[model samples]
Target: MKRLAALGWPALGVVTLVLLWVGAALYMGKPHVLPGPWAVAETMFSMRGPLVVAAAKSLSRVGVGWLAAAAVALPAGWAMGAVPALDRELRALLSLLRPIPPFVWLPLLLLWVGIGEPSSWMVCFVAALFPILAHARQGVAETPVALAAAAENLGATGLHLWARVRVPAALPLTFTGLKAGWSLAWMSVVAAELVGADGGLGQLILDSRNLARPDLAMSGMAVLGAVAAVTGGLLGWAERRVAE
Candidate 1:
């Protein structure tokens, strides 16, 4: 009974949204521009295989790029946080690069890496790196001085101090960065896929537009939204587990 009660509002909200969507579609009277839910559902069902394949490809690219971003960000952030001189030295360069939008690098990357997986990954890497580094730097910088002093007194030095004291202290903020980086990476991958890829959710949307299929385009958009939502939720759950 309690479980059913807990589920009720969400179910009700879903139904309400469906009704509202149907009402708008019917009232709008332009199937070509704004297909009804049923039309979109049909598009989704009929093209499930292609959608799944495209989603998988996009997810793979995003995963690799995101991991690479974390690899670079964590170590660099740790170094910058632990050493004030290094942080100051990198500050000017970071400032210049950070303000430059991720997409702005696309042209340069396209020229260097060409239109391929490398270029796509580069876009994702750039998009994911800054947030993680920013959050990580903040996390490490905010570690309590007293805690560090205690660790030093206890004979923790050099790498041990960073490993035991800094990393753990920074975990929460670092987690925040990871979550943000994941989202940014996902969006960046889709954008990159759309711009030049042969196949992906982005490419599917591009194809739909080329074929004048608004229903298909909308379906792709919906799938992208769903993927991002699920991924974000899973990451948040993992963060909570880590925190505990």
Candidate 2:
């Protein structure tokens, strides 16, 4: 019953949104400018094949970038968090970089890596890196000193102390960072693809615009939103399990 209520609320919200969208489209009386929900849905179904291929490509880029970011950021963040000296040295640099949007790197990446898969992956990596790194540092910094002392007294030192005491304590916050990083990575990959790409949902949207097909463009956006929502829901469920 509780689960039904949880699902019902969001379903209601989506229905309400669709109605509003349809109404707005009717008021405009121009399908080209703002296609109604039905038109978008039709376009989505019609382009399923191309959409699937594009979505797969985008997901692949996100997956590769996210994993790479996790590998580099987690260790670097842990090291910085564990050592005050290292944290102090890097804090200012990180602060400067954090505010810069991932999309801003597009032109530079294009220049450096050329207009290809590598550039897209690089942008996604940058997007995912900061949040993960920040959270990891915070998680480690917030670990109880008493816990570390206890482990040390028990002959836990160096890597063993970090592995058994620090990391376990910080897992929850680390997971939070991972979730945030993934969201950023997803967004970044889409933007990267939109700007310059041979294939992906973003590229599909761009192509739709060029072809004067607003319905198709909206369909691509809907697909992107749906995919992000599903992935986020799964991540949230996993996060809850980890917390429990």
Candidate 3:
């Protein structure tokens, strides 16, 4: 009951949004220009097959890229935090690279590798990498000095100490980075797909515009929004579990 009550405000907001949308769509009476919610819903249902396939492809790309980023970032970030010399060495380089958008690499990557999964994966990897890496380093570096001293006094050493003390202490911030990376991965995948994807939600939206089907484009947007909602819910649940 409390959970349902907690969700009530958000549900009301959605309802309000839909109501306003219906009103605007009705007043405009231009289905081709700005489709009503029902029209987009109909398009979503009618184009379910293609939508599913596109969503799946994009999701797979995100999964691969995010996982790859986590694999590299977790270890590298830990090392940077563990070793002051390493952090000093990489800090300047990281600052230089982080500001360059993932899409900047797309053209060069496309020219080199051709448009496909490789390009998409690379874009997603680049997008997801920085935050996870930065946050992980911060998390470990910020672990209490007293905690480390205590652990040392208890005869904890090396990787075992890291595993028991630093990892747990770092998890909250690390998870924050993971969630941020995951979100960025989705955004990057869409951008990557818009240019080179044979099939993806981004391509679907682009095609809808070219075909003059606003409803279809809106349907694609709705699907992406649904994905965001689902991702947020799952990430939130996982965060709570770790916190517990």
Candidate 4:
């Protein structure tokens, strides 16, 4: 009974949304421009194989870029956060570069790397890097001085201090940043693939558009949204589990 009760709101919300969507699609009365849910579902069913492959490609790109971002960000963020002088030195440069939107780099990347997997990877890398670094830096910098002092008194020093005390303390904020960074990476990959890759959900959408199939375009978008939702749900679950 309790388990069923817990599921009530989510089920209700989903049903409400589906109703609203169906209402809108019916009102629009033009399947080409505003494909109904049924039409989109049919399209998705027909193209499941291609859609799954495209999703896998997109996920692979995101994994590559996100991992690279984390590799660069965690250490750099820790260093910047731990050392006031280093933070001051790089903050200005970070300021200058961080404001530039991810897609703005697309043109330069296109020129340098051309439209390919490399361009897509680079775009995802750029998109994921900044948030993780910013969050990580903030997390480390804000680690309580008392906590570090306690660790130092107990014989912890330098890397050990950071590893044992600061990093663990900073986990919450770092996790926040990591989650945000991965989302950015996912979005960037789609944007990159739209113009840069011959495969992936973005390319699927592009092809669907060129082929005058709104249903297929919606199907691609549906898959993208589903993946994002599932990833986010998993992250939330993990975070909650860790907290517990």
Candidate 5:
């Protein structure tokens, strides 16, 4: 019953939203401006093949870019957090870079990579990298010094200390960062695709707009939102497991 209620509320919320949307569309009486839910659903089914391919392409870019960012961020963040001297040296530089929106890099990337897959991947990487790095650093920095000393007294040192003590302690915040980074990566991929891609959900939306099909455009957006929600739910589940 508890589980059912938990699911029930979200389902109810979705139904409410759909009803509101349908009402608004009917009130406006402008299908081009705001497609009804039924129209969007029809568009989704009709464009399933293209939508699937576009989603796949976007997901591939997100996966590769996020992984690359994580690979660099984990160790780099750990080192910076574990070493005050290093942190001090890099903090100013990071502060400068972190505030810059990931899309701002798109133009430079387009020039360098020529509006290709690499540019898209780079944009996603940039979007994801900072949050992951910042969270990782914070996690390591917040590790209790007393715990580290205790581990040391028990003959734990260096890698052993890090693996057994620091890493475990930092797991929660690190996962938080990872989840945030993934969301940013997903958004960045869509933006990148919109700006310069041959095929992607973002491009599909643009194509629909060019062809004056608001229903298809709305359908593409709905699909993107659905995919992101599912992925985010999985990540949240994993985070809960780790916390447990």
Candidate 6:
């Protein structure tokens, strides 16, 4: 009942949005320009086979890239947080790199890695790496110093100190990083794939546009949005679990 109440306003907002969309579609008086919801639904059902395949391809790319980013970032960030000297040396470099948009590196990545899976993966990696590293480093560095001291006093040493004290203490912020990184990776993967992909949501959108099928492009956008929503929800659930 409480959950229903909480969702009421959002449901109302969605209805309001739909009404506006319908009004716009009707007023413009051209189905080709902007199809109504029903038209989009009809189009979607008719092309469900190809749409599903494109969605799966994009999602697989995102998964591969995000997992790679996580594996690299967590250990590196943990190390930077654990050692003050390393942080001092690396902080300047990180600050320099963080502000540059990941897509800016797309050209160089293409040049170096060529237009293939490697290039797509590189874009996602670049998009995800900085956020994860920043968050993980912050999380580990901010673990209560007093608690760490107490652990040390209790004869916790090296890996034992990290395992017993640091990792658990830092998990919430690390989870935050993971979520941010995943979202970034998802978006970047699509953008990268747009230029070079033979099959994926990005390619679907690009191809639809090239074929002058705006409705199909819109459908592809909807599918991508749905995938992001589901992925984000799962990440949120994971965050809650770790925080708890």
Query: What lDDT does each candidate get?
Result: 0.89, 0.91, 0.91, 0.91, 0.92, 0.88
Q: Summing lDDT over every window of 10 consecutive residues in candidate 4, give the lowest-scoring window.
A: 235-244
Clashes of 3: 0
The alpha-carbon deviation from the true structure for residue 186 of candidate 5, after best TM-score superposition, in angstroms, is 0.7
Of the two candidates 4 and 6, the one with more favorable lDDT, higher being better, is 4
Residue 164 lDDT (model 3)? 90
In candidate 3, what are the lDDT values of residues 67-109, reduced to their tens digit? 9999999999988998999999999999999999988999988
Runs in model 3 deviating more than 4 A are: 1-5
lDDT, candidate 2, 92-157, per-residue tens: 999999999999999999999999899999998999999999999999999999999999999999
Give the per-residue Cα lDDT of candidate 5 at 236: 94
Q: 76-104, model 5: which lDDT tens digit per residue?
A: 99889999999999999999999999989
Candidate 6 global lDDT: 0.88
TM-score for candidate 6: 0.95
Of candidate 6, the 10-residue stretch with the lowest lDDT total is 189-198
Candidate 4 per-residue lDDT over residues 1-244, each given as its tens digit: 8989889988999899889989999999989898888998998999999999999999999889899999999889988999899999999999999989898899999999998888998999999899999999999999999999999999999788877899998888888988999899998888899888879999999998899999999898889989988987888788778756
| Tens digits of lDDT, candidate 1, 42-72 | 9999999999898888888888888999999
Clashing pairs in 1: none
Tell me the lDDT of model 5 at 19: 94
Q: Which ten residues in a row have the lowest lDDT in candidate 2?
A: 235-244
Winner by lDDT between candidate 3 and candidate 1: 3
